[model samples]
Target: MAIIAGSTITASQYIACSEKRDKYGHITSRISGASAKAGHMMRDNVFQTPTHTKEYDAVIIGGGVAGLAAARMLHHRGMNNYRLLELESHTGGNASFGSNKYSAFPLGAHYLPIPNTDNQPLLDMLAEAGILTGYNSNGLPVYNETDLCYDPEERLYIHDRWQEGLIPQLGTTKTTQQELKRWLDEMQQLRAIRGTDGRYAFDIPIANSSVDPAFRELDNINMRTYLQQKGYQSEELYWYLDYCCRDDYGAGIDIISAWAGIHYFASRKGKAANADNSQMLTWPQGNGRLVQHLQQFSKEKTLQQTIVYKVTPQGNRVAIDYYDMRLHTTQRIIAKACILATPQFVTQRLIPGGTYDHDFVYSPWLVANITLDRVPESSGYQLCWDNVIYRGKSLGYVYAQQQQLTQVQPERQVVTYYLPLDHLDPVSSRKYAIALEPQQWVKLITDDLEKVHPGIHEVIRDVDITVWGHGMIRPHTGFITGAARAAAQSSPYKNIFYAHSDLSGVSIFEEAFYHGNKAANALADYCS
Candidate 1:
């Protein structure tokens, strides 16, 4: 359909999502064509204030993972004179969840890696969630067996059969196998190498990575250039590495930074007495459970459906102007300190001389949840938590309820399919994504799945599609160690602070949580 006239969508086609739900969670009959219009309005909204005003010690805008973390930290410090404002009716930003009678599934992010030994905030969150029981005599943490992924952790569809893991070496030449092994061994060696500063060359949250000029210079070039310079020409290896780039950065390897590319492999140092770095921690509802835990503060104090459009320094306080969509009133808040915990794109638009204008590039993504009456049997392995195709453009689906522990399998199942729009520029990709009709998406999704599961098309009952215009930031060449990234960590104003995953040059649960905690500590010192 074309862009509906007059921003607000009262049209029948867009409103049919409510009609499609069957006594369970609401289903998306279409790919939210209304979001494009709504998003434009949000960006283009003008700022003004009515007669209403409120006072608080701090005010947090944008209730995503970062905002929630800041709020939770502030509450833990006994700072209750604060409020959180969210643009959506619900919280959790990308870490949202949905449910039906059969199961609950993730809407965006699905899992978290085992925390590195240096990442204290992440480990604390996991321990509070009951996933981390205690430490062993070796000083390594012990994980709850239930939270760790069960047997048959992963499988890949290739060579007309399912393999035990995602690596595709079932039918390659001996030369290709040797090359792949060489790459794996190199990664292992790099993982253990430390810098002159006694720090691992690359570690979680990216900030703790070694600052040695030898390694830091890797950010000056793209991953493709780095790979080609190393005399690595294995097509299979490139395909696998390219898949990793698309899965994490939502961009092609040619455009992603070499430092970010290698960091994807070396930064993960998660270890446990019971689980290895390769093991993951996940739930049926994904990171939404973590979002809920962070939001365990005063609900009555929060202001949902609120848009913050302006932030200006007012003497020793920061003046925040926002409009509440639910109340249809514009209000003002004079906060002693402020945390703009929003995406880079949104934050840049909210204030003057905004950071990240020249260095940040956010990616666009597509996620479709497929609800099936019965999962059709495939030719290879029965089923695994994560299923990937050897050379496919889209990352294969994840079994949504794979963590459910029922002795007997349920009659129905759900799988979430992910696709990154990297074939074009971000602006063009978002336009093309929103213009696609529901039937067009259905055809595309079915065609992608039919490669492995022959009859999956017939078993699919419902398909809900969610499109993210600015999904996550891409760490392009010269970004990770550049001046723009370093300068973005602090705000121009003394009383106003900034926090978001984009500031870290990469988007992930660990980085966002760490960024929020760091910002909270900085702002807390000044709040008193």
Candidate 2:
């Protein structure tokens, strides 16, 4: 059917969505589209405030995981005369959640593998948050039983059998299995090997490592080329590697730099007593629980909403100009030091003419949470914590309520599925997302779920599609080299500082926290 742009959509073109379609030929999503457009206008209208208005010791722009972490740390340091400006009403950025009749669930990030034992600060934070109990006989930390993933933790529906791991098994050839084993063994070696400069080849706080160019050169090539050079060619292994890269980094193997790709596997040095290093601590409400704990240290009086327009430095202080959506006024905040924790893309807008030599590549993602009274049972194994269709386009579904492991009212389950829009560039991916209708999105999600569990459509009560247009930046080749870091640090005006995970070229919780902390310290040092 031919649909005209800017014209009232007819009954046939309405594209029915949940409770959006009516007998009167009206589609609620269409109205929602209009509402969303109006919301954007309202948000932009705040920028029209002509005059500057207020002052402070520091102005922190953005309120994502990184921004909030820095805010908490700065607050703890007794810096109360500062303002945290967020475009969104609430904080937590990608770690945000959505609530419905069923329960509150994550829209983006969903889990955190037990962190490295050496990361004492993170361990201390987790303990404070009540996620950690105590150390075992071996000195390994033990997580709260309530937060651990329940039995039937994972399964991959490949070759028509239920496998314990997410890897594709059953109907597999010997060559495929050998290649997979070989790859894993290689990763294990990398995990253990230390650099000549006396640092683990893979460690967090990326700067703490030895300055060895030999291993650093690995960032100059793509993962596909690196694997090819190693003579490890197996279609199944390639697909699995690609899937991992897409799931976490949002980019495919060919696009991600070889160093970053291998680092993904080798960097997770999490050790726990009751759980494996690879195990995750997740909950029904996703990472919202962690965000709540992080917010405990935020300065209550210094947070403002939908403000921050332009920033300029005047000798000793930085002038921050922003618009308040609720008050419909423009205000200014002057601070001794400022931290910008927004994504690189948004950071580009705030800085009028700042240019960095390093290229920042981001991948878009779609996170769907399907609420079901009952998920269709598989033939071989029961419902597991994480389920994936072998070699499928979709990243599969994670049972959000699995951690709690209790029969709650409404008998709800949230299947969080991730799909990376692996487009050539950000512009193309965002355009593709904008083009899809709400019904099309639902169909896109439901069709993929049905592939693994047939007849799942009937059991699902609700479908919430949260599209992260630019989810996480790809750690492509050369992005992590010291040169890239240097390029990112070069400020447009001596006053602005970059503090986004995108600048690090890798999007992990550790990197995000470290990035913010680095920015906070740099700001402090610069002003002092």
The best candidate in terms of TM-score: 1
Alpha carbon lDDT of each predicted model: 0.80, 0.72
lDDT tens digits by residue: candidate 2, 428-474: 67666666766666656666777777777666666677777667877
Best by lDDT: 1
Superposition TM-score, candidate 2 onto the true structure:
0.89
TM-score of candidate 1 on Cα atoms, chains taken together: 0.92
Q: How does each model score on TM-score?
A: 0.92, 0.89
Q: For model 2, which pairs clash?
A: 53-332, 57-335, 57-336, 308-322, 309-321, 309-322
Cα error, candidate 2, residue 70 (Å): 0.3
